[model samples]
Target: MKNIGQRLLEERRRLGYSQQYLARAGGVSAHEQRQYEQGEDLPRADYLAQLAAHGVDVVYVVTGKRSTVINISRDQAQTLMDNRVVGQEVTLDGPPEEDLYFKLSDPSGPPPDQS
Candidate 1:
């Protein structure tokens, strides 16, 4: 399993962010960012929260597993798949729009046959 620093570094690279840029965005110094990426230091809660606000999956960075919750109806699921967006912003509280909600909720099988 990758260490937390490795995961953070990978995520930053995946987003095409330089350590300096990520540090600025996360409100940390570039040296601090390097330390975090090198596993010489761990980020504080505020820094992690800042990263999350900038679209970093801090949970995955820390745990090496992405956290996901699925619970949509069939129709909603189909709609979600049909209109899938790569980096769409998702609201997690209430039910999603019909399509997005379904996709997130249901994991039954292939989408219904469309003839």
Candidate 2:
């Protein structure tokens, strides 16, 4: 299995960010970022959260597990369909009947009475 540092490096490279850029974004020094990529050190929780905000897959970087939730805006989804990036058409309205990678809970309890 790959180490967390290796995963962090991969994610940084995937985003085309330099060590300095990533460090600045994560509110750390470039040296620290280098150390993280080299597996010499681990980032703090706040730094990890910063990385997530910058679109880094923090969960994958730490635990090597990809998140099941796939967040895409309606416009982005429409664009994917227009470009044939997705083969199947999807409706954003209502809960999906089938199981998906992530499940949405009914947060409001139950619907109001029709009567």
Candidate 3:
């Protein structure tokens, strides 16, 4: 398992962020950011929250496990963020929009087959 600092550094590199930039966004000094990335110091909860707002997956940084964060939006990638997916389970919330016209109007894809 990677250390928190290693994971933090990995995330930072993945986003192409400099320590100075991330530190400013997290309300910390660049030196502090180095310490956090070097495993010399642990970041505060508030600092972590700030990093999250700046696109850092703090959950993954701390726990080495990514959180169930889904972008529930009308515009995104080709994959549809269906409401039926809750956490790790696929749930049936309702009849699932049976309107063929609605499906045709949707850009995600065609409606699921009833058969």
Candidate 4:
């Protein structure tokens, strides 16, 4: 089995995320992230949970075979799809459901009203 550090390093590289950037996203210091990636240390459970939220499964990071299960219920998947909007914020007239269209927003960047 590959080491946890090696797996994390590979995944991070695959995602094109630098240690500093990932650290910021995971709410850790860059130095700590580097240490974990370099096989010099392991993060705490809370840190691992944060990584899992970012799509890094702890079992895969540990054993390198993706032994973790990624089971999203139908309702959860629908909720996720319903909430997702690219390059814009959405406001719904009611709860998320089928035929839920989005209200595109500016994303608060770039020139306004260019679309």
What are the lDDT figures for the candidates, one per model? 0.79, 0.82, 0.78, 0.71
Measured against the true structure, the TM-scores of the candidates, in listed sequence, are 0.61, 0.64, 0.64, 0.56
Error of 1 at 106 (Å): 7.7
Measured with C-alpha atoms, the lDDT of residue 100 in candidate 4 is 33
Residues 1-115 of candidate 4: C-alpha lDDT, one tens digit per residue: 5677888888788778888877887788999999988889987778877876666666777666654364554566556656776556544354444433233444686675856
TM value for model 1 = 0.61
Among residues 3 or more apart in sequence or in different chains, the pairs in candidate 2 whose N, CA or C atoms overlap within 3 Å are none
Residue 104 of candidate 2: its Cα lDDT? 43
lDDT of 2 at 53: 77
Q: What is the lDDT of candidate 3?
A: 0.78
> What digit string (tens of lDDT, one per residue) describes model 3 on residues 1-115?
7999999999999999999999999999999999999999999999999998788988899999876664332332113434434455333333444211111244677789999
What total of clashing residue pairs does each candidate reach? 5, 0, 0, 0
Once model 2 is optimally superposed onto the true structure by TM-score, how far is the C-alpha of residue 98 displaced, in angstroms? 26
- Indicate the TM-score of model 3: 0.64
Candidate 2 per-residue lDDT, tens place, 1-115, comes to 8999999999999999999999999999999999999999988999999998788988899999865566665666556556765567655554444333333446787788999
In model 1, the runs with Cα more than 4 Å from the true position are: 69-115
